[model samples]
Target: MDSTHEQRHPHRVVVKVGTRLVVDADGLPRRDFLNRMADEIRDLMDRGIEVLLI
Candidate 1:
């Protein structure tokens, strides 16, 4: 595909979250990190990119 096509269209992304990054010592979700990630994902969405989190 041409660079212009890529620049004009939205791209799909698969974001794989590591277990360590998603869980804490007690096996709980890390809210702070999740929140930061959400913010980043929101930014990407705003730019017309699709994000799939795993």
Candidate 2:
């Protein structure tokens, strides 16, 4: 058996964006915050990071 044939470590990660961060305290959805979060996610994807959003 070859020792170098082991499976690579998992790099995938799951990120949960809470409602509190996506919405205001008054339970109103915020577009500005959502847009910023989207941009950040895009940046991470550009770096080959696997992100699973729930």
**Which 10 successive residues of model 1 have the least lDDT summed?**
19-28
Model 1, 1-54: lDDT tens per residue?
998998777597789887766665566579976777789999999988999978
Instruction: Write down the TM-score for model 2.
Output: 0.55
Candidate 1: count of backbone clashes, pairs at least 3 residues apart or interchain: 0
Residue-level lDDT tens digits of model 2 in 1-54: 354543353346587877657575566578876776789888878878788998
The total of clashing pairs for model 2 equals 0
